[model samples]
Target chain A: MKTNGIELEKEILDQLPAIVLAVDKNFNTLYANNAALTFMGSTPENVIGKHCYNMVRNPQCKTPECCIAQAMADGKVHSIRSEADGGTGNRFLESTAVPLKDEKGEIVGGLEFVLDITQKVLDEKKLNEQGRTIRDMSTPTIKLWDGILVLPVVGVIDTNRAQHMMDSMLNKILSSNSRAIIMDIQGVAAVDTAVANHLIKITKATKLMGCECLISGISPGVAKTLTQLGINLGSIKTKATLSDALEEAFSMINLRVITTEAKQ
Target chain B: MEADSFRLLNGVKAMMDSGDEYSVSGSVTNRCYIACINGELSSAQMGQLYDEIVRMAEKRELRGVIMDLNGLAVLDSAAFCVLRKISGALALMGLKSAWMGIKPAIASSLVDFGADVDDLCICQNIEDGVRLMSFQK
Candidate 1:
């Protein structure tokens, strides 16, 4: 009955989808299930007595920082995610190592559990790249004409995005040597008295940098809120549309665009 | 160090005389008092809060008052108006008032709601507040 039970346990281990194996205290391969053997590219007969680390296909096997070695040293379970040369190709995997104990409850070896996490790692990296792309695309500083920079505002302006806009605007102004900047707020949903004040501060700062800042597209609702809040934004120039602001920007720089459609 | 601290999470309890009484943090005859507000303070609580600060300021040679809003989460327009009112009262009492730990959201909203921060001296934290209020400015 005990013999049959041992065979049953062995059969269950062999059928497990995860690559599982056990190594003795000396790091010798004591047991390598079918999946482990497949990972090693060798039969149990050829792998069982070999050094556990050397038998594994992972390049980190020779290093003392291996999860199994750490588990054996501490006589506890340890896990680490690493890229390794697997049975197929290089793959990222979470290698979990649990200390194997003798009958007396002393750790004599360790059982290693490996689960491929290549796709998960790749997906996380892709997500981070997408986030960077979104942030970059969201804030676009445009130079409409020489000495004129236009920042078309849209969507909600969180504190982080507001700070980012400030930084980007200052840098763009310095780099372009522009004399005027038209901040179009047509697409923005709402504005508070504080935002208007912050906008005034930005224009004041731009003025210090020798540039005129024009705030265009002041919606009636925002205008009403500002007045009700008792915030005075009368000091800053304003316009209803981007084109009107551009025309004002042109007049400030002593340049006028006389558009006459050529007869074709 | 008298080590007296009071917390009123709800507004109704603050109105009834027994709950809001507390001592200042420093010397036995300390002139400056610290009120560390925790949790949500609704608009209804502002009247009680103002009365408490006035009561605390009465006849104690009050040099300064430190208001710490580190734990406050939500702030409405009424609350902001009450804050402005309380600051004005403190100024009238010849007390130097310092506000500490104004969360980013509250700071933004205060500005958005046309609440002027210039009414009170704003500090970064309790330590900064203590230092600022300690000096005779």
Candidate 2:
């Protein structure tokens, strides 16, 4: 009955997809389950009694920081992420090392369980790239008319986003030689001191480039907050509506809009 | 000790050399002078150019002067200050001065460094500069 129990355990371990391996304190392979044998592309005869580092190469295999070595020394489990080579190809793997002990409770070797995590790593990389694309798309400078441009600001304004906004505005002004730009803040969440300062800095920078910057879409709540904070936007043109701001911009550039009657 | 210090200062003066990193040349048209400037210039070079412009203005019956900077790529703080001074000096002499073709990057950089450019009359091109001068006259 005991022999049957041990065989059943071995069979269960062999069926597992995770690689199960055992190495002695000297770093020589002692045993490997079927999954490990297949993953390493080695037969039992060639794998047994061989240096595990030479058979399965990893970034930390030859270093003192090896998880297996750490587990053997501390008599505890240790985990690490490694870029490793397998029967298939290079793979990202998560390996956990558990200390193995003898009857005397003396640490003798380490048993390791390694899981393939290539797909997870690839997914995380893709998500990060998508995040960058979204960040760039969030802030856009659009040309509204000849010699006129408009930037519609939305959401929270952080330092990085503010710098990007300034860069985009400056580059667009240069490329188009725009004489005036209207900044609409109707979609902004709230106007705090820092946000107001960022807007002012952007205004001053545009002015330095000989382009006039007008602030529009100032809600009553934002105006009250600006006054309460005592933040002075000196000499900057502000309008209650985008249309009024556009009218001011037109005047600055010596332009005007006139209505004509439709012909019958 | 004082005599030795004086001799050392004199020797240092003798070793000093001067050079201009930029060139300035233009023409006088219809009582309006256009000074085409190119390349980066040191403070001394800018001062020399300012003096040359002022002398030329004194020599001719000019109503306006356009400092064409389309070819100038770099302007440090000192050079920029001198440029402003030149504009002010020309205004004092009753000649309308307009800065032409100020590149976008340089203009932004000047503001970033906290240089005062509030009163500068900036023009998009030579024709706009001429129109600005003519209008002022």
Candidate 3:
């Protein structure tokens, strides 16, 4: 009956999702279950009798505020987020350290349970990027070309939107391999020194990547603001309207311009 | 330090001075460089901080500004909006703003909040923040 009970306990421990490790008060590894060995990227042979910090390569071991150490000292459970160098690579883990006690209620050692959470973190990051993309798309000033790329703007440019525009434009250009980019800013509210500089950077980057960037729909107010900012847009080709910009872009790429009358 | 100078609460030092509170010391300048965050910066505090930073940009010529949030637990929507506003405002002022000392939990929270942290200069520590800011200058 005792043998059966031990076997049942072992089976339950093996089925746990988290890696469980038992360490002595001195931080020496006493016993690690199969999950622990797998998570620590080591076999039981190499892990046992070794210092937990040495086996885990945790820098916190040298610190007085080490979670495991604090847990052992206070005889309480301590939760901490730590990074570990798994055999594959560095991995982020959420670790909970619990003090182990004997039948007399005296603290003997600590037990650590770690759960890998790298995937969840990456997913969150990706979702955030997606949200930004969606927000950028909702800007009425932005116009999507070929239903894949966007070019929208008019008036004074804010640095935040400019950065977002640059990133979105670059991603679109790279992904779609589009030949032309048309930025229409007919309703732009204002332009300042910083906005002009950001525009210049974006134009230069776009052109360097073998894509032709065309500016169109520049309002008179924006032109005056650009002049006041001492920004020289002479190097960049701009048109008074989006249609003209598109026509210029098509001509540069050696594509014959189709007239609206012809399409009708 | 006097008892009133520093209070250990919620595992953080809350230093209350004469209408000013220094949350954490980033580095030692002539005076101890500290991050002054208003009490439990809610959504309104985020917007207020962003506006204050923008006003500072208009008044002084800064090469770069550092948004040190070592004292913050969570930067919610309003806080995230403030960061965005600061980034935009800095560009208008011909300056840069680097976010420094972002804890992983806060970083993850920002991600969860769908904040755009990509364009801004982010550093893990105050030292790295200073280094990056100087490099930009």
The sequence of per-residue lDDT tens digits that candidate 1 reaches over residues A1-264 is: 235778889888898978998888888988988888887789878998789867775766768878888898898778888887756778888989999988998989989988889899989999999987877676787999998999988887666666566566766775787768999887778887657667866665555344678999988988888888888877789998999999999997789999899999
Query: Candidate 2 residues B14-133, lDDT tens each?
Result: 666434433469998877789998888767778788998888888997878888887888888888888888888898999888877777677657766777776788766667667777
lDDT of 2 by residue, A71-106 (tens): 998998899988876557878989999999999999
Could you estimate the TM-score for every candidate? Answer: 0.47, 0.66, 0.34
> Which candidate gets the maximum DockQ versus the true structure?
2
Preferred candidate (DockQ higher): 1 or 2: 2
Q: Order of all candidates by lDDT, from best down to worst?
A: 2, 1, 3
Kindly report the docking quality category of candidate 1: incorrect
Winner by TM-score: 2
Name the regions of candidate 3 deviating beyond 4 angstroms. A1-3, A15-17, A39-46, A73-76, A83-90, A103-106, A135-264, B1-137
Candidate 1 lDDT tens digits, B11-115: 445665444443323221246677776655644566777877777777566777777776677667777677678878988878777765555445545544555
lDDT of 3 at A99: 93
Clashing residue pairs for model 1: A194-B111, A194-B112
List where candidate 2 sits over 4 angstroms from the true fold.
Answer: A1-121, A262-264, B1-21, B25-37, B60-74, B102-104
Candidates by TM-score, descending order:
2, 1, 3
**Candidate 1 error regions (>4 Å):** A1-4, A57-59, A62-64, A72-78, A85-89, A101-108, A157-177, A185-248, A256-264, B1-137
Global lDDT of each candidate: 0.74, 0.84, 0.66
> Which docking category, incorrect, acceptable, medium or high, applies to candidate 3?
incorrect
